[model samples]
Target: MVRQIASRLFYAIVILLGVILVVSSLVKLVPGDPVDVLAAGNPAMTVADMEVLRERMGLNRSVPEQFVAYLGQAVQGDLGTSIRQGVPVMTLILERLPATVELALWAVVLASVIAIPLGVLTALKRGTWVDYVGTFVAVLGVSMPGFLLAVLMILWFSVELRWLPASGYRGSALAAFGQAIIERDPAVFWNAFRYFILPAISLAFVMIAVNARLIRSAMLEVLEQDYITFAAAKGVPGFVIVIRHALRNALLPVVTIVGLQLGALLSGTVVIETVFAWPGIGRLAVDAIHVRDYPVIQAVVLVSALLFIVINLVVDGLYRVIDPRVRDD
Candidate 1:
């Protein structure tokens, strides 16, 4: 296990370096100079002043030299200053990360709570209308685009019904709960939930569909195994056999799906966040890209890649816990 983790860490470092190099190279290829963006807002700036600023920000350096410098600073936990905001990239990321994390967590939790049981039921009732309906829903979810779903949801829930706010983010439920405990106010939690529902559901819809399908397929396979048949032959209760024996074994694939989708959700929330006007890293990254804020853009990509790597490592570790066969191997 220790060796596995060490190997994964080594690979993760390599991947992060590649991500940094790629992002740094690509940002330069983007039209319109960061220095020009800076000078645009300041009309008093002359061409010589722009050149001085460019040299000062190290934009005049070759790509390889800039990448080396940036990588060095990044190694020391300095992501450098954002060209647009003139603030530390890490500070901007940290400020917005909690919202993104909260949204992703809520989305995954909601997906798991619904998908796993629905999948199980569909598999168990394979020939019934329940199976047909679950399959239909899963197909619809997988086919529907997240941004479109988010917009439709806003029109239905926020515009037509006016049941929820159309746009804006309150603090996350966990943060609100802490505040509620301190201030003896429960309204904080409710506010967070209300703000969370639309965006979380939109983000989770595809994951739920995908996970449910995967789980259903896994459960079907698991239920057909010799041990499952033996359990029934031994007079095991149907529910116990299904839950304890079938579901437990079937969850390996579900874990993998959830881990990967959770990572995707973290990085792919850009459109949803923009639509909802949510104050998260995805939106921040989008804004940074408009002006080619290299530090902020690179930091967001790096952070998202790091999260993806870490989640996969966690999923690998979970394999042993979920299946004894993995540990034995």
Candidate 2:
């Protein structure tokens, strides 16, 4: 198992490097000149001054030399300063990373908590209203756009019901000192949650549907196996038979999906984040794209790619522990 993990980690690093190289090359291939952008924005710059800026920024370097320099800087964790903000790319990412992490965690938790159990129930009660309705809901989630759902949620909950704040994360009652609700301010975390509700739901609702449907299908299929009948004949309790025997086996594929979605959730929430006013990496990446912040864009994409590689490693390692069969192989 250790050896397998090591091998997988090695491969993951290789893939990550390859992806970063390709993405960095593509960023430089963009038509616009950053030197001109800088000069235009700096009204004091003459044409000669712009030429000096271009050379200083290494826009004058040969492509191969530039690529080599980028790799060297990236290896040293110097991801370069943002073109628009003028802050270090890594610094900008770190500022927003915590919030994005928290948001994604909440979203994933919301998705899985909502998905897994209903899925099991749907499978167990197949051909009934529960199953049909659940299936229909899953279809609906997959069909609708995430941002639209977020807007609808805001309209219903915030505008109409006045139940929660419309946007932004709440730091703390201690931090703000104005919104405290007593000995314990449930308001802060709770409002943060409420603020996240629409964004999280919109971001994860499709995921929830997918997971539920997958779980339901897996359960129903597992239930039809002869081993399930044999277990029943042996007087194994139904719940144990389902949870211990079937669910564990079915979880392999589910775990794979979960791992795959983690990276996607980080970078794929752009539209939803914008509509819901949720601050996350997706929103940052979109901004970087519009402003042509090459460093920020490159770093964000690299982060997403690295996250995907890490998730695959984690899931593969987990499979060994979760299933003895994989460990043996």
Scored by CA lDDT, what does every candidate get? 0.92, 0.79
- Misplaced by over 4 Å in model 1 are 181-185, 327-329
For TM-score, the strongest prediction is: 1
Candidates in order, TM-scores: namely 0.97, 0.91
Q: State how far residue 323 of model 2 sits from its true place (Å).
A: 1.7
Q: Which ten residues in a row have the lowest lDDT in candidate 1?
A: 320-329
Quote the lDDT for 189 in model 1: 82
lDDT of 1: 0.92
lDDT of 2: 0.79
- The residue-by-residue lDDT of candidate 1 on 1-329, one tens digit each, is 67767777998999999999999899889888888888888999999999898889898999999999999999999999988778899999999999999999999999999999999999999989999999999999989999999999999999999999999987778888898889898887888889999999999899889888899999999999999999999999999999999999999988988999999989889999999999999999999988878889899999999999999988988998999787623
